[model samples]
Target: MRNVMILLLGLALCFLAACGANESTQGNNGSGEVEGQDEAEPAQNDLDYPQKPISMIVPFSAGGGTDATARALAAASEPYLGESIGIVNTTGGGGAVGMSEGINSTPDGHTITMVTVELTTLPHLGLAQFTYEDFKPVAQINFDPNVIAVPADSPYETIEDLVKDAKDNPGAIRVSNSGTGSIWHIAAASVEQATGAEFSHVPFEGSAPAITAALGNNVEAVSASPPEILSYVESGDLRPLAVLAEERSDALPDTPTFAELGIDATIVGCPRGIMVPKDTPDEIVEFLEEAFMKGAQEAEFVEYMETNGLGLVVGNAEEFGEVLAESHNFFAELIPQMDLN
Candidate 1:
């Protein structure tokens, strides 16, 4: 009986030891699985970022330069983004309404805005409560330089002729711009600063109307993009005197730049780019930058810009941010000096 009891106790002890070992192994396996799951969670989250469609807001009406560029970019980026990008035109307040909507978006990378050079000027003009700094830049798609254009039958055939006439008769040469505190207005002001000439700056609702005013001989000249006046120039209704760029545009190879004409303003006209709300996630911004950069380089997009006389300036987020900062600084000083505010 003593031997039987001893054997029973030994069996119980062995069983307990085996059970404890199995429990320890199971606990370790569970902990290992949990650690592995934790490691994968972040990567899964990263991949899940843009799980829906995106909305791109254009602040101008359809058929304008901003709208055209926005559409091109959205189309080109859709394939790479694995989702469709819908363009929404929220035109008003000189682009303030659309920009405000973009700024006030959820910052989840679904909502973005096509920003223009007006972004730098609108705040100074009291047209918007936000500036370029209010949003995070994604990429710069285009930079169409402002062109000094006049009626086809105008006597001012060149920049020199226009400046000479304007200098001789300060505030007499009527130069029409898109609006009072618009990018074209700043271009007109820069022309005056460079040549010591004064133009009777006439404000229109937009570039189309301003160009129309010049074409109808209501204004002596129109400061606008090459694309804005390309058809007219081709149709012999308008003559481009000079482009406000450091170099000549391929779209207008015959047209000289401001630098060629001894004018020093290198950057002018409307620079259109993409941006999201400032607090958007860095990962999302990076993804968008990559996608848009790829989109800007697409053959179809390049061909469209070239055919339309639009300047192609492809840049990533950091480079775009730098350009925006420079533009902001330039306009900040120029606006005050020109009394645009």
Candidate 2:
């Protein structure tokens, strides 16, 4: 009986050793197959991928809002991604060029695009060759409320005065918008609808140029976010008439909102988010979302948004997708009403 018990104990010890060896092999190669056995390779880790530098394509000109946001996000995400992110400015066709490039790129997870309000509105207006379905969302970074401003020397002193002028002269008062179907243009249209007015819609490549035209007195008024016109407003070069939001902007609290005047028009501003080609691997999207969420929470990003009149709206991939879906539906309904194409 003693011999039999010793033999059983030895067998138990051998079984334990075999299990240990299997685990050791699995740990070394990340494949659970036992030594000398053949099996499919285990899933890959992100660290093993993107051996080359990544690229972030900004669908607008350099130094514009999209470019700036792209750079900020890249700076924040590079350390976590373990690779350098290259930013390429491919501007034209109201962001269609860069967006097309991003969509066509291999979805292996190295390419992403920084898009804003147009990402939602352009499709409905027949402007976007590719819809939101073409891109996989990563995260949202900022939400900027559109503002209405006029030349400092313009006769209009209030939003009411501007609306009255537009009402008095339909399609006569030239108004500058960032682009067709953009949030800025939507704000402009909202003003026209609320007040039953008409203004000649003048489109520009981006907010910077639109605001620049306003400052240069090339246009009677400009529709852009506070960030694009803050300095001009501060320097007395431009006068902010009102913000197209439910409440006044903290940056321009004294400036009233369209609602204050009994115009039920509330554009609620617009949010900016990050996206990659639709076919990018789910794991890569998660990797990017995690990195960006971490960067967004950093004190620097928060301070930057606060100082720049941009509202920070950070969300994970799933949450961002919901926001995108809602915005997509909202714009799909809104563009037809605006009669923009």
Candidate 3:
């Protein structure tokens, strides 16, 4: 009896040790990190979003207008966010690649996309891997109407003169745009449709390069945002033909709208905004919208935009969302009619 009792006690002690070991490792995911949270990542709720420095993805070249606006906004918004906002320039695939990376990121508000009008156009063109349905808009922060221009010393004097040149040349006029399916390209194409211009559509990576091409006389005309080509126009290196908007820009009041020029052209320009991945929690999206909009409205940010001739168009999340959907549907119908598609 004594020997059996002693053996039972030994077994009980071993079982207790096993239980202790299991308890110690209950939440471990191996590598000594807990399953739910780790030392580096403390437990967080929806309200506690952006525990780390946020990354804003600017899907364009660094020195472009988009990049400059993104940097300015980030600097302005950092105070409200209480964390640094880093800008990441992911350029390629006519902006589809960078937007893909932004939309597919960890579905956390930490990674935001500085989405542009391309967000709607790319999916319709079959260039993007994702669709607008994957978007969670923070806000629409900018709206720059398209401006088509030529070198200052070009033979074309007026908007009508440019159209006449196109009609006379029969696709000989090399017109440069930001990309094949870009907003600027659509502007150039719309001009072609309206006036039977038959322009030789040459696409570059971004507006800066497209404008550069026009500056070098590689292309006879270039279509880009007014803010982008403002310096060139002011410097007399380029001359504005027409703006693709209902009204003229404050900066370029002399630049006539397409309607004023008697061209029934499709208005195309980049309206940029902030968006997080679609799966990001609602509270986080709300928080981001409020913070970003407030940042966009900051005096310094507004001054920077106005100084650079960037049109500031701020809207709430819902409004921005409506704009995206409406623009998407418009392009859906419009893309079917275009020859480029």
Best by lDDT: 3
Better structure of 2 and 3 per TM-score: 3
lDDT to native, each model: 0.75, 0.71, 0.76
lDDT of 2: 0.71
How many clashes show up per model?
A: 0, 0, 0
lDDT ranking, best first: 3, 1, 2
Q: Please write out the lDDT profile of model 3 over residues 203-267, one tens digit for every residue.
A: 87778899999999999999888889899988999999888776787668899988777788776
Instruction: Estimate, for each residue in 167-253, the C-alpha lDDT of model 2 and write its tens digit.
Output: 988877888877766777877887787678888878877777888888898999998887777778889999999887666776787
- Using TM-score as the measure, which candidate wins? 3
1 against 3, candidate with superior lDDT = 3
Q: What TM-score should be assigned to candidate 3? A: 0.84
Q: What is the lDDT of residue 256 in candidate 1?
A: 93
Off by over 4 Å in 3: 1-46
Candidate 1, poorest ten consecutive residues by summed lDDT:
34-43
Report how far off residue 192 is in candidate 1 (Å): 1.3
lDDT of 1 by residue, 1-341 (tens): 22112112222122223322332111223222311112111122355767799999987767667888889888877877878899998877667788899999999999999988788888877778898888999987776767889999999889899999999998889998877778888888888877788899987656777888998999999988888788898899999999876667666789998877777653555668999999998988988887786676666776777689876666668766876776677667657777442
